[model samples]
Target chain A: MNLPAGETRELLAAEYVLGTLPPTARRRVERWILLHPELAESVRRWEHDFARLAALATPEPPPARCRRRLENFLKNERPRRRLTLIAASFWRYAAPLAVAASLFLVVVLVERVRTVERPPAGIAVLVGRHGHARWVLTMGHDRMHVVVVGRIALPPHKSYELWFEPRAGAPMIPVGLLPNRGLMTARLPAAVYVRLAHAHLLAVSLEPAGGSPTGRPTGPVLATATPQAV
Target chain B: MASPPEPALPSPPPEGRSEDPLAAAFLACRRQDPRGLEKLYELLAPQLFGFLRRMLPRKDLAEEALQDTFVNIWRRIEGYDGARGEIRTWIFAIAHHRAVDILRRERRLVPTPDTDLESLLATAPPETAHEPLAQLEETRLRDCLGRLSQDQRRVLFLAYYHDRTQEEIARRLGSPLGTVKSWMRRGLLGLRRCLETP
Candidate 1:
C-alpha cells in the first residue's frame, strides 16, 4: 500500500471525508491532519468536492414529528439561567443586608434628599455567561439606568440590546440598548414600564451597532436577570 | 458472484443553485440563533434521511440516526470552524459517523450475512437516480462521476451514500477484500483527476 507521500495523504483525506476509512484509519487520519496543515487543507478541499454527491441523494423529509422533537430538545436546552448561584447567595443575605442597607440609606437620604431625588422601584443584577454579574439595571418611575459592572468586550460594529420576556404568551419586548461603556439612561414609556413590571425575565443579546434590525433578539443571549423590588 | 444490472443515471440539474443560504444558516446556528437550526433542518433533512436510509437496514433505524445526527449537530455547532471546511461537509460527516455507529451496534446484535450484499445490490435501485442536485447544478463533478466504470462507481457510491467500509462493501458485493480496497482507492483517485481536469 505504498504511495508517494503527497498522493498517500490526499487519498487518506479523500477517503476520510468520503467516510470510507475504517475506524482505526479514520482516527489515525484525524490525528495526522492536525500535524500536517497541508493534509488538513486537502481534507477540507475533498469535503467540498464530494459535497455535491451528498446533495444528490433523494430528499426524503423526516417525519413531521421529528421537527417537533428537535424543537423540544432545543427549547429545553437554550435558555440557561447562568446566575442561579449568585441569586441564591443574594437571597441568603437579603434580609439582614436589606435591613442594614435600608437604615443606612434612610439616614443618608434624610441628609441628601434634595440632591439624590427619587430612588429606583426595582433593581436587577444581570449575570454573564461565565456566571459573573456584569450589569446593574435600576428601574425608576419613568426611566431605566443601566450601569456596566464588569468588563464586556464587543466587536467594533456590535452592541448589546435589552429585552423583557413576559411570563404570559406575549412576545419578547425590546426595552433599550445598553451603552458600550459606562452608564446609559433610557426613558421608559408607560406601556413599556407596565410590561417591564410583568416580565418574568430580562435578557441581553448582542446585535449590530445600533440594535437588532428586527426589533427582536436575533443574536446570542449573553446574560439574563430577574428584577427584585427595591 | 453475479453483478447487478446498471440503473440509468439521472439527468443533470439546471446550473447555478447556491449553497449560501445553508452556510449562512449554519453560521447563525453557531451564534445560538434557534431559527438557524430550523432552516438547516428544512434544507438538509430530506437528503440526510435518504442518505441514512441507504446505509441503514430499516426506516426506523434511519430516522433514529437522522435525529441523533441533528442533535449532535446542534450541540456541536459552536465547535465548527468555517475556515476548516464547508458546513455541508461538517454535517454530512456527523451523519455518516452516526450512521456507522448505528450499523456497528446493529451488527453486534444481528450479524449480517456476507451473501446478503449481492442480493441487496441487485435489488437496490440507485436512490439518487431521479434526484436533482441543487448545489452541484453548475459543477461537472456529476459528469466525472458518470465517467467512472460501473464497478468503481458502485464501490464509491456504497462507500459515500451508504457509509460502507471496504470490508463491508466487499462482503456486500461478494468480492475479495483487497479488490474492493483497490477499487475504492482507484475510484476516488479517478474522480479526483476528472474533477481536476478542467
Candidate 2:
C-alpha cells in the first residue's frame, strides 16, 4: 500500500518485516531503513510485538563457537560501511579522471581492432564528448603496453601526451609523445593500472612534443580520465 | 542447561503496564549494563533458539542464525525505545529479522510440498524424542496455532522465516502481490490481537 505521511511507520515497517514487500521494493525499504532511523524503530517494534510466539518453536541454544563467529561477522559490517564511505568521498574529485581513462582506453582498442582484432587482455579508448576517439590502444602485450593518444582537439601549438597512474606508491609516470595525430604510448614497465583490467585513472595532457622535460604533463589539457573497468 | 530456577517468578500474565523485572533488566542492559546483557542472554538465548529452529528447518542453520541473532541484538540495543513496545518484543523483532536475512541470503526455505493450500504445514521438527521444553506447554502453542486459519498462518510463517519475497509469496499463493501484502498486514494484526488477548 502507498503509505500516507500520517500512516505511522508501523504499517510500512510491519509489512516490510513480514516480507510482504516485493524484492525490488523491499530493497528500497531496506535502503530507506538505513537512511531513516524512524522506519528502523518501527521494524524493531513489530519484531518484538510478535516475537513471543516464536516460543512455540522451542528453544535450541547455539554452540559457543557459533556465538563467537557471529561477533566477528557483526564487526565486518561496521568496517564495510566505513570503506564504502571512503570510496564514495574519494570519487568526488577522482571521478572525472576515471572517465578520461575510459575514453583513452576505448580509442586504443578500436584502432588496434581496426588493424588487428585482438584486444590486449584489456583496452580503453578515450573519446571526445562529440564522439571521437582521441586515444587508441597500441602496445599492451604480455610485457609492455602502449596507447596512442591522438586526434586530441588541442590548441594550435600544444601537443597531447599520455601519463600512467599506478595503483599506489608510484608517482604518475610520464610516457611517450602525442604527434599531431597525437599518438603516444609509455611502453610501461608493467601495464598501466588502466590496461591491467583495474586501476583508478590514466590521463592525457596538452604538452610540447618529447613530453615534459620535467617528466610530467603540462598545459591546461582539454580533458583526461582513468581507464574503464574492463 | 538448567532453567536458572525461576527465582522470584514475576507473574507472567501478558506483561502489562507493570514493569517486568526481566524486561526492565533487558532494557537496562540494552541501555548499558554489560552484565545485564549477559544475564538477558542467559535468560533468553535458549528460548529464542527454540523459536528459530522451527522457523528454520535446518538445525545447523538454526544454530548459526541463533548466534547471529544475539550478536545483532547486542549491537542494536541502543536503537530500541520503549515507546514502540516491550523490550522482549524488540529482541524478538531482531531475532526474526536476523533469521529472515539469513534464510534469504542462503536462498533456502522450509520444506513444504505445496505451500499454497490453506493446509500447508511447517516442516515439523523431528519427533521431539528428547522433547526439550515439553513442560513449556507445547500444547498451548499448538492451540494458538490452531486458532489461525491456514492461509493466515502460512503468511505469518513465510514472512517471519523464509526466502519467499512478497512477489514470490503472491506468485506461490496464486494471488496478486497486493493480496499477499494485505494477508500479511491483516494477519499480523490478527496475530497481535490473538497474542494480546486475556
> lDDT winner among the candidates?
1
Categorize the docking of model 2: incorrect
Over B80-132, each residue of candidate 2 has an lDDT whose tens digit, in order, gives: 44545555666676777777666666564445332222322343432333323
Worst 10 residues of 2 chain A by lDDT: A188-197
Per residue, candidate 2 scores C-alpha lDDT tens digits across A17-127 of 665655455555654553465776767655554554554554566678765665465455342232226767555544555456555565654665454434444455544
User: Which candidate gets the maximum TM-score versus the true structure?
Assistant: 1
Candidate 1 TM-score to native: 0.53
Model 2 segments more than 4 A misplaced: A1-13, A23-45, A61-230, B1-34, B108-145, B170-198
**TM-score, first chain, each model:** 0.51, 0.39
The C-alpha stretches of model 1 lying farther than 4 A from their native spots are A1-4, A19-28, A80-230, B1-20, B110-134, B137-139
Fnat per candidate, as a fraction, reads 0.50, 0.50
DockQ of 2: 0.21
